[model samples]
Target chain A: MNLHEYQAKELFARYGLPVLPGQVAQTPEEARDIAAALGGTVVIKAQVLVGGRGKAGGVKLAHGPDEAYDRARDILALTIKGLPVRKVLVARAAEIARELYLAILLDRSRKLPLIMLSAAGGVDIEEVARTAPHRIVRRHIPLEGLRPYQARALLKPLFREGSQLTQAADILMKLWRAYSEGDCSLAEINPLAVTPEGKVLALDAKVILDDNADVRHREWEIWRDPDEETLGQRVAREKGLSYVKLDGDIGCVVNGAGLAMATMDLIKHYGGEPANFLDIGGSSNPEKVTAALRIITGESRVRAILFNIFGGITRCDDVANGIVQSLKQSPLPIPLVIRLTGTNEEQARKILSENGLSATTSMDEGVRAVIAKAQEVTA
Target chain B: MSIFIDKSTRLVVQGITGRDGAFHTGQMVAYGTKVVAGVTPGKGGEKLQGVPVFDGVAEAVAATRANASVIYVPAVFAADAIFEAADAGVGLIVCITEGLPVRDTLAAYHHVAALRSRNGTGRPRLVGPNCPGLISPGLSKVGILPGHICKPGPVGVVSRSGTLTYEVVQQLTHAGLGQSTCLGIGGDPVIGTNFIDALEAFAADPRTEGIVLIGEIGGSDEEEAAQFIKRHVRKPVVAFIAGQTAPPGKRMGHAGAIISGGTGTAAEKMAAFEAVGVPVANIPSEIPSLMAEAMGRRRPRSNRAAAGKARRARAASRPRPAARDRARPAAKRARARARKPARRAVARAAGGRGRR
Candidate 1:
């Protein structure tokens, strides 16, 4: 899950990280209250789960309470990248002496945590890498160990001279601890701004915790946002299936994540878009199928439903029964294509036919049938 | 001659008393896998499906001499199960459970790597903590991989897609090919046993003739595998990459499938495979046939071209029941109120939202 800047900062503050005092406000009056509490110039930023908010007029500097309210009013009502502003983060603006970038993320290739650092900060890191790849510095922390000194070494170039080097290294080491102990998949302190007074503050923060690690990281649970996706995905999650909403017409219900991806690819290859990625996983219970189909049909963009269950340990008969049960409950008006394989496939097909639902056994035939039905309906 | 599991590999079931554990164990045992023991805390000495259940992995390993382990534990405890099996010196670990915490996986992966490096031996090969697992027909099935569809043959398989593995096997079977072994490496962002890992094993296996590698858009797993193929693998590999036209910047299905900037795309994977001398098949249906042709099968020329043609023609020939199915009621309602102009009820069935 992705936590907004305010949410991440709040968690960082709770963990004793140096963070600027900030409050979230939904209206101008609330912004004024937040500014008055800070009693200084505050930065008003639009709360959206996207980047480049500043470039889009979603972030502004407010001189005082009056300016804070004006900026919040403008930003709170504006939309950035099609996501409406529901909240604005009002933070006390920091005096900058120097800026640096630091982040820790999983390197999939190495199967270990990687720490990324750079002297350049407060801009898109991708741009920096593209334009001047030499500036960005990265270090891999082996699974067997994490050395604080090694992490500090990655930021050695940023130290340059004077007392700033020790302070920067100290901050980097502390950030590494926060990255590891916090169970953060991504912990970034962009523009680790140095004030004229020479104190470091995490002027901006972005932290994404591993959702699966939520059990281990007890304090991070307050950052969970259940309202990110469509209701179907939330329902599917509750039912223990992996479902991600997509923008398309065909409702794809497949068995495995990889297969689900391939099925979606096939849908697109056939010029038919997939509406969602719903994987019932290895279980083929009728209830799970019922839940998956109900979630699919409940979707407004789904014109046709495709059931691609390559039953292995999951009996095909069980998948067929689930589809039958789901159809009985919802009475699918949209065209349905069922492709059942693996253990007891004949029995599965027999059950479907017996229930007056003849599903195609061929994947090509099943995908073709669903795509055609989708086009016919939309046409 | 199979890559990983064969008749000689003794298997142990972890979390044996659980519902999925029991169900899949029954299916695997019926499918001829030599399931010697089960491991569940406090369930030691109990018999499940005529197999002895042990209290721990060490006990199960010591008693049964089980070299292979299939874990069915929940996501919360999956990492511990893998670590337990890894610690117990199990030669092969197949984890069928999904939803392992990323942090746990990171720790487990590092531990496994360390053990592999520290022991002066390779890591006990892990298939998945979130995958469907692997099946070696007429050998030992060490996972919850659906074995009913697989039969013994000479074809080697490695895939990031679980369901696509079946699709490839079905086509291969229809084409008179049986797989020596099939591995579903899974599509989770973090997984055990990547394509390169399986490719190395399949390349060395004597029974395996050629390999069918199916990959999807996301991550550099496919690219790494392709590089390995170019560097070491001599086996003729047939590759099918998924999500060619997936919308830019939007995640198709896998969290790793998001196209950020320019790298890690299906097209890039295809190019990598092609550059590595691995024949890339764009259409899914063409996979088995391409492998068959690579194996020196006499296929009709028209059929091969038509398969590609059919994929294109299929774009426009998709079946639609909505118009005819829903129109029946609409036509009757229109006749009932012929005096008034018919106001079309906005089709809220599917593809209703996001219409321009």
Candidate 2:
């Protein structure tokens, strides 16, 4: 549900936030057209979801349309962090007098929306926190929304009570509107730049929409990146499976999201890297299980497939049936490990045993069995 | 003696005409829950499984005098349902629905909190937006928990997972242990109840001799719970954190479950639990043993009648398809038939998005 910088800025502008005027283009010619219309030094940024774009040479500056076109062409050809640059955003670059950080996000521990501010900007906030902790300031916004006086208080430390403070506070308030009004899970402006002309602009915007809120905001789907998924992910989405492919060798299929992660963690603890995070979810139908198995086996790196199901409402017998049918279709391409427990487990075990397969109720035993099978050939 | 629900509890089911609402309602009633009322907007005059249905929560509350409300509505309307329940003066609310919009939850949460502050008594307790609800063995079952697997016992449980909570509960019951109450606070990023709230309630309950806390790698909730355990809880607590080896920056199913910038890792949570004198189980199965040891050190069992009632009730409620004499495919097909309407309701309510 993360939006590219261009998309984020589009929402920002809708909320009257001080973001520089920008346009998204698919080609270098389009980039040139945008830059020529703006008639100023422009920043051409590659539109990809991955972070560290500047470090990856995905961002460049150009003084004119020709240079803008050249920069966009170069960025478009580059693949940063395995994601191709399909789109580029061209905007009038600003001369900055000061740069600061501002963000509004859900503080999980507090169960509240929190706004964090910092005097330092254009650098990773985590790095700033690690190096100069006092430079950053944090505030929790109550349900009543951020007040004008409170916004003033947030800016007071970064500035002496003046126009700079008022203007920045206004921008922070606007950022809150884009966050709350837009129903974003996370909204940030990394470099809230103060221009040489004393105008504050959101230099870089990032908005992570709350996926659950999509029903409320029907128009948000246009921001989806078409190429951001793997084949397994695409199929899983259509099949109603929760799957995230990872750079590992052990494939995992589990019921319930929490148990899936724990299964992966346990595998890692026993010296195995999980190939993906797959949660068929509760009361999974047989079709989903078949799809999960097919998706995992499709990946050649997978040396073992693990099924860790702790069924409550999800009947273990249903899962066992899925496993049995999958094995019948073709011999398991890799070793199989299962730890099935809870509701209908006795029936599930009977099915597995009749098929010359059995499951361990113990998670530790299941983890060891899979890791051993995985290591048999690799060693 | 349970932390939340008990024999005196009068329950109402929201979304009672919907698929999940109707199915779990039958299970709850069969498990001996006093589900006196149901609410489904336009279908209020109808009777669902002998329970009276109302168009609004206020009418349902007034008619049936149901103090506890369990929600099985679609995620889109879940927040409003909660607000409706709270507005109608339901003392406790358990939302089994998942994928509620976080901002809507924020507003709903604050509304409930504000009401609690204004009243200062019988404040609403929300269980989950994506959870299995909860169970008080032999006394009341207000959620989708397999009641047959639970027995009333000395330990009270709270977790942030659905089946994992049931798994630990199952292991606890399998080894001749029973539970007083178990709470699934859910896996959503913003939820009403956390480990701290449940811990405080368990600490005050007389029947709970020991407690089990199952946490996953997520927000700083575990750490906050650790601090609460250290300060408020004198009862011996056994804890386990899931996702120990989860990689940084990847969300492991739960929206609240991402490890951002090396914070909220299982290692940090385990360290906090250990620092607070709570033993963290190495594996899920080891929890019952740890709880046995922890309970054995401090107190002897006193709630014997409840335990016996739990055992008898569980024996009575186990799903009959596991008898093994029946045809397996027939049983599965029958179960699927029973689940279709509810599943379809859930799918339609889910609107084909968000984490299930």
Winner by lDDT: 2
lDDT of 2 at A189: 95
Cα lDDT of candidate 1 equals: 0.79
For every candidate, what share of the true interface contacts is present?
0.65, 0.74
Candidate 1's displacement at residue B99, Å, is: 1.7
* Count of steric clashes across candidates, in order: 11, 4
Per residue, candidate 1 scores C-alpha lDDT tens digits across A197-315 of: 87767889887766666777676656655645668877886888877667888998888766777788788877888887777877777788888888877875788999887766567
In the order shown, the candidates' DockQ scores are 0.35, 0.46
List, residue by residue over B1-356, the lDDT tens digit for candidate 2. Answer: 79889988899999999999999999999999999999999997999999999999999989889999999999989999999999999989999998888888888888898898898884887777788888999999999988988988888999998877877888787665689999899998888998999999999999998899999987898999999988889898999998876777777778778787679899999999999889998778678777776765543255546665786788788755357436567777777757765334323332332112
DockQ of 1: 0.35
Give the docking tier of candidate 1.
acceptable
TM-score of 2: 0.88
